[model samples]
Target: MFNISEVDKGDSDLARLVSELDVFLSELYPVESNHCLDLSAVSDEQLRCVIVRDEGNAHAGCGALLFHQNGSAEIKRVYIRPEYRGKKLGEKIVSAIEGIVSEKNSRLLQLETGIHQQPAIALYRKCGYEICDAFPPYTADPLSVFMRKELP
Candidate 1:
């Protein structure tokens, strides 16, 4: 069975996954256009980091929610291992984050992705996130695409 739960961002295995995500993003976009969160940032008490594990206890993927004081949350650092993609794990991870968002009383969830990340974009839309204007800490960057969904 596949299991999804909140995990420590400082865990060795999850840390390695985050490192790979950073490298992948760095290679895909310029530093100026990348807004991917660092491990320390995700480790903050305000963010809840989650990991997916398979039946044999292998890490499948991970994602996080950054809680703001205004009852809103931002999804960040969603990464699936290269070998584990195309299995609908991305959609599950976001749904898991949405459950957590609702529990925390967050009324909205937002995220910023790169224009070149078609799969990520599709996943977000499938999860009900729609295109939105840039929020704080984000601007009108041609390379960036902002999306948000209201929690029901």
Candidate 2:
């Protein structure tokens, strides 16, 4: 079983995983070219990140949640390694992020996925997120799939 752990932004394992996440995102969305979001430093800009690791020194999956208050937050870069997919590790990472949101007393969970990413859309929808009109900062992209779920 994989263990979900929160480490400092300086953690080496997390640094590598975040690098991989950045590279993957760049490949998926080449036009954005946002390398700043891939940094290991918290910069007061990121609220929190969650990293999961197995028996090895590498990460199995990783995800981040940003707090916007206003009873809302965004889930970003939820990723799992190819070998770990279909084993529900992605769901575990997602559940962990949602739990963190709940702890922060967030009432809404909003996320952006790509239209070309059908499997991810299915996973988010299965997790109770519903399709919604694109929100702020994402209005320019017609390919972006914005979704939100209300916390109980």
Candidate 3:
């Protein structure tokens, strides 16, 4: 069984997962197109992170949310280990993040992903996030795909 739960950004497993994700994105996109937050930013108080672990406590994936003062939030650093893909873990992570958004009364949730990340784009669409124009703090970039979903 896999378990998803909130964890400190400083958690070693979470850090490792984020580092792996960073390397993966760096390989696919140029530095400018990679909008992922660094470890320092992810450790900020405004961000809440979650990690997925298996029955034996092996880390399988991780994700985070950066809350804003306007009752909005951005999903960040969502990644599932290559070995753990195709098991609906991505959906679970997104669902877990959405639950946090609802708890925080966030009216909107948004994210920026690379255009080359087809699987990510499809997962976001499956979770009801639609393609949208670049949001604040984000300018238009050909290699970037912006998406958002309004919370109920």
Candidate 4:
């Protein structure tokens, strides 16, 4: 069984996985475009990122459930390795993040995925996230998409 675990920032495997995430986003959206998250910028506590591993060896994917400590949180940097895609790993990560959001009393989970990521958009929709207006801090970017899901 694939297991998802809470990870600290300094882990080498996770650091490499996060680097891959950066490359994936940047290759799709340029660094000059100011769209992808700079994985090296913040410390562990500030982000609360998570990783899903395969049999406790290779890091298959990584995601972060970031909170403003209010009633909202952002599900950011969710990425799966190319070889590991289509196995429903994205949904599993989202489900794991949802559990964290619930525990934090967050009523809504927000996300920003690119327009070209149709599969990701479909996954978000399947998970009950509705397309919302371009929210602040992301309103000016035409390439940005905002979606949200309300928790029970």
Who wins the lDDT comparison?
3
**Clashing pairs in model 3?**
none
- Which digits, one per residue and each the tens of the lDDT, describe model 2 over residues 1-152? 78887666666776777777677666777666342354444454456778888777568888788776365888876778778888787788789889988888788998888876788899998899999987765674666788999989
Those runs of model 3 whose alpha carbons end farther than 4 Å from true positions after fitting are 42-44
lDDT of 3 by residue, 51-122 (tens): 999899999999999987777899999999999999999999999999998988887999999989999999
State the lDDT at 140 in candidate 1: 82
The models' CA-based lDDT, in order, is: 0.88, 0.76, 0.92, 0.79
TM-scores of the candidates are: 0.94, 0.86, 0.96, 0.89
Better of 1 and 2 by TM-score: 1
Instruction: Please give, for residues 62-131, the per-residue lDDT of candidate 1 as tens digits.
Output: 9988987777899998999989999899988999999998888888999999998899999999989999
lDDT by residue (tens digit), candidate 4, 1-152: 68888777666777788788777777777555445655567655456778888885678988887775455788888889998898888989999899988887788888888877788899999999999976545664566678999999
Global fold similarity of model 1 (TM-score) = 0.94
Relative to the unseen true structure, what is the C-alpha lDDT of residue 146 in candidate 2, on a scale of 0 to 100?
Answer: 86
Evaluate model 3: give its lDDT: 0.92
Ranking of all predicted structures according to TM-score, beginning with the best and ending with the worst: 3, 1, 4, 2
